[model samples]
Target: MSQYGKLMLDRYPEKMILPESSVIMASDGTVLRRIPLPETGYRIKAGLGEMPQLLIDTFIAVEDRRFYSHKGLDYQGIARALVNNTVRMGVSEGGSSITQQLARGLYLNRGQNLLRKLNEASIALTLEKQLSKDEILQLYLNQIYMGQGQYGVKSAAERYFGITDMKHLEIGQIATLAAIPKGPSIYNPVDNLELSAGRRDLVLRIMQQHKLITTEQMRAAMKGPYIPPVKDKTEIVGASYMDAAIKEAMRQTGLSRKELCAGGYTLVTGMNIEAQRAMERAFSQEEAFPPDGKNQRAEAAMVIMDQRNGEVAALLGGRNPSTGGLNRAVTPSRQPGSALKPIIDYGPALESGKYTPDSLLPDIKTTYGSYSPANLNGVYRGQVSMRVALQQSINAPAVWLLKQVGVSYARGFAVRLGMELAAEDNHLAIALGGLHSGVSPLMMAQAYTVFANGGILNKAYLVRSIRNSQNQVVYSHVAAPQQAISVRTAADMTAMLRQAVSEGTGRRARMDVTVAGKTGTTQLDLPGVPGKANRDLWFVGYTPRWTAAVWMGFDHSDPDNYMTAGSGFAAAMFSKVLSML
Candidate 1:
């Protein structure tokens, strides 16, 4: 190799350059996802020619006073910085010209060492020779980080000020953000109000000293209250949910994460932005679970589906969808309690050709060996129709009806409805939601969706479609509904469930819209806390438009925690969200 080539090879290691692909948008042409790449994180490109003159002038005034005259290095400014640092006795107290700053940000780490400084100077000089000053400055601006996870000025302006066009920012706002790159954390107006105001004043002082701003203008700017706007910080922002859905789709579809993030394509999803916002508003504003430390947090999960097509409309893994740890809506595996009774008892009876909505079942006190079941109120009303039994969720009558029908047959019926019931000797408890294996809220929502769709079961999907840079559809969730039950049985079940919403334990969940639902509460497994109570409390419900499940109970092994009867808390949130819809 040539001597210069050897030196160059030894100095900077070769790294592959990957160009970012444009983000794929939804069918509505809304950007939903993109291929993931480090360089592609929230970046948008615009040529230097398209940039506003005011923006360019702002950069020139704040970044490089001698930018137009200097080749790259501003020796006078460097010498002044050295002198200033020597006097101030602080690191980063000296001057770095715009070119040097850009070189360090784009080509080298901002380390306070001699090697990095040398490299920065070499690269800055090299870049000055190769590219026009405007081009270099535009690239620098595009790549630089402006606090708040905003990588570019455009992103920063939108995030902090909600302005889109570059020309919208006032001179003072531009100066404030221009000063922020020096120390983002300390000077962040949102984080440290006083420090940010002080730094803004300092920038104004610098501008005045350079005669960029009049003394009178500086005085006027200083008089204003530097109150920063409050960031919403709510977890359910559009960008946040879309980002998650894209990641989840990537995981489920086994697509390249990079392509999904940076490769621009159209991504259609099952999400309804309006419904999601409404659901988020309902959840964030209300207490959805019990407040006692045992069940202090009102964790809930909601899954909405398109009844006709079986697409997942909205899925909230928890009351706060942003909760980082557990996603109950998608993953919580808890016993359905009485909520399981519909599949275990009613479904089989419907399939057996022996039961109809009007069929009467003896509502007498019932027993299986030592297990004697009672109504929720500890009393029974004898000789009720099947519709009344299901609507009231009467325990003894359901147990008797299940016994008359048979558990193994009921298990098979539930399986047809998409519930994977673990093998167990089905007994009276099956009528009361006793299950060998637990089910997730998503699973429950899906199972209920069968009834909502008049026996058709469609696979739940979050993504609608994904397209590549060429706009060719690479992946799409096609709607395919399966016939799981006869239409007659489904309609009957819906009618009974609707009655449950109107007059039974799920009355708390009644909404202005037609709704159907069930309520469940198991004895706390803890001995003393509730004196032989079980561990799960639940309310699973659906409207003409949406389906949601709420589970409350202590995950603690000892279980001696306070219990939240699922009816009040979960039902309240459900009702609130339904009202908004």
Candidate 2:
């Protein structure tokens, strides 16, 4: 080949490089999530051998009649197109072939001037001489811009028909895709099915007239239904989890948010896609958060962490958990009521070598410096054991137990187990969850894992790893665990919490499997109201395999009783998620 030939051939793409979106997958290689990069949908290119011959026939039959016969431009076809344009009295026919379309769309300018057209024709002829016909056709198929941010034939097929491989395209489906380039918006089946069907029938006619397809084949294709792609049914929801992954990634690596999302990175998360969808369905779907005129002001959040490894399997931040912002799982801790009793007061009290499950404690009405605590039902079983007090979630008995155990030791131990306790809260009300600063659902989840995993407090992690565009590993997961308490304490507390689930206020959380958990409902006082209100309900629990924290409350404080308004909703939601796993 001459030097000029080599230079001209160099202008053609050596290999296509598509700007792809980042994908997050589970450990098993299921696509748990896909985050669109700044401006493009995923575009994985297809080759000529993978494309169907029927689609190629329709493309050639509609776009260029003399494609194989012409070198670059068909002069006779150009004259025919010119006469047709003149008869129509509008600039319609360009008389461009497959090679010309590839040349103009990929490299040359889009202009109607004589000079621009001549340049485009020159490039087309150069490309034709340097490459095979099949190669040029492959380039054309992979470079056309189908609407809705799709780039290649494979992407277009998936976007329009939900099919991944182009070889699966039947005659009618091929005609539907073939007609899209005529006028992308007008002929796109997703936009206008009837109009797209008309354009598809035209392509079928062209194929029949050129004898590329038989009359019977054309008739059958015309009679077939033009089914568009299925509605997007991605089972996994990454909005909340992806946000957490990116923020944690930034914190670990000190990379900016813009740098993390600027493409060329894969985020491997420990979250299971199926578990995520199940949690979302139980929390966000219409059945769970029904708009049927009940508790409209109510919202909820949950977090499930693997007790063995601390991998975050699923997380739901709010009632509407899909569109993520202001995650309730991580920040803005609210009072955890009796749910805080086991982790903060009881666990530490038992861990301090002073308390026992069978130890006797007063459950009668108790008063401490003008602060008198009462049970939920207002009638307490006098002189109950520490185990009974925790299992039944009786208020007065907890305050008495806290007084006996002392506040500083319980508070310090709770902090070690990841409770963000209040500083000025030196009062005995801390026993009944009267802290100035409350604990987050995330902290509660991590702290509870100690009980589930025999006293090991493992840090909760969402992202499994992050990789650059070159598939180089940037960060990987490492288990960071600390033993917060003795196994005896964990075992005793687990027994009490298991009793709470089996026969106490947390009975709603009782599932087919053995569950150990506690229920909490904080009482609130609102202005312009006569009586007390309730908010911030929770049921933080764990099985031998999973530890989950579930919270339900109002976005804004209200006078409605959510437990009755949405009775057992929080525990039921947790149970629903557990049943799926």
Candidate 3:
């Protein structure tokens, strides 16, 4: 062998193997779904034993007849193809064998030129030398492209006939799948059924001619009914949860979606199925939301995190969301309203060592540098306690407390708690949840974990671990809790928020179990409107075991499309989810 051939043989094994689809499982080891390969769609590897004998026989008989006798390059078949093309005055016959086809699919593109064909031949010769006959055939079967974005016979079987095991396939179905590799687009059973059936009959006839199957078998298979391909419904359950898990897996592994899909990794997520279903049920109820306005329907998003390890338990981006559509739960597009008070205003004030729950904060009209913040009720009591100020969600006191705590210092503190505040947010308006960019429900839930987790901020995550196809642990999550506030401060903040839920703005969220939460609403400024019209409503809260953030609004809030309800609506929805849990 040449030195170059030896070098090529050393590198062939890594390149010859095909990518397999990654699987995603829930926390309890329940299989959630399989992520499809990047451009190739879905693929599942099949061993030689998993493939039916009929499929193997039909594929070999139609694709390569002299497979057992020929070396990598079939000189006799090549000569015959050349003569036949010359007689036809066109390229109608392919001289490349199954090994050459595999090499081209794996290492080279399908270009009908001498250079590409030469490269294919060299690689095929190397593959034949390196792998045994069955190995070569197994790789060919698993690596070949079938149709409809499927990569192998297994994926095509599951896709075209909805059959997981090849043994369940009829003889005609096996022939149809075997016929697709010749021209996947032309013989696709889903798109061109008549053409695929004709090709399947040709394969059956070829199998009979090779004496691989009897004449009676061939006739019966040809006369069988050809069912059109059905859409695979394996991903119908937990589609949105799977999408979010995939995104988190990509982020944690530093792998792109394509890489994660093709890596064959098993991602174990922290998804709580019961909590997910409860959140879904709450969001699906039309009565849970306010009546739709003339122009738009209200939308809502929620995120629930397990406080034990900061793993996201349940998430709902919106009602009836498309699988990969806009995920509002993770996108920080809407203003958080008074939800920012606990993280920025009160929490920071308590941590500053200068304030307490009973500290008398001035609720009188206050103005600083042309910025005059007002209470939502347009009435303020002078010298209200800090606890009452937070419970009523009085805006003036929050802004005043932020002024005392210093905007820069409070913003820095909120950052440590997982709120992504902007440079422009270094102002008193943040006390009222006014900002250049808003926070996502995910960010809100993560921030609230500080209070639920005894002053330690546990970052929320979805994936707990990932294992590669070889059953090797590739990535595992480690709990890293950052101290954002003192235990006393967290307890004080929780006390105030608990009162808020029991008697104040978040009273609608009170449950049988111990719950602490706050409510927030961003008012819409519309001239001639009687009362307050809200653009955004929010309720951020936590229990002993879980932290949750809920937001309600329209995607685009305008005069015609705005919220008429207050944050109590969001709090009530939260109560519904908690009840189900």
- What is each predicted model's overall lDDT from 0 to 1? 0.68, 0.77, 0.85
325 in model 1: Cα distance from truth in Å? 3.0
The TM-score that candidate 1 achieves is 0.69
Instruction: Please write out the lDDT profile of model 3 over residues 1-581, one tens digit for every residue.
Output: 22444466576656665788998888888777777676647778888898888888788888887887887788887899889988988766769898888877887888876667777788788878878989999989988898888888998898888788888888788889989998999897887988998999998888888887789989999999876556545334466667888888887888988778887789999888888878888888999997677788899999999876899998888887767988889998888889889999999899999999999999899789989888776897887999999988888888989998898889888988987688888778888998798888999999998998889988888899999877898889998988878999999999999999998989899898988999888887877654578889999999888899999999988778888888889999889998888
The TM-scores, one per candidate, come to 0.69, 0.71, 0.81
Off by over 4 Å in 3: 1-17, 38-40, 46-62, 75-96, 103-135, 157-244, 291-294, 526-531
In terms of TM-score, the best-performing candidate is: 3
- The candidate 2 region of ten consecutive residues with least summed lDDT is 558-567
**Each candidate's root-mean-square deviation in Å?**
6.6, 6.5, 4.6
Best model per lDDT = 3
Off by over 4 Å in 1: 1-50, 57-100, 122-136, 147-149, 167-247, 252-306, 309-322, 351-354, 359-385, 394-418, 421-431, 462-478, 525-532, 557-559, 562-573
The per-prediction tally of clashing pairs is: 27, 0, 0
Error of 1 at 110 (Å): 2.5
Report how far residue 486 has shifted in candidate 2, in Å.
2.0
Mind giving the per-residue lDDT tens digits that candidate 2 earns over 262-338? 55468888887777778887775555641221455467788998988888888878866555587888775678888
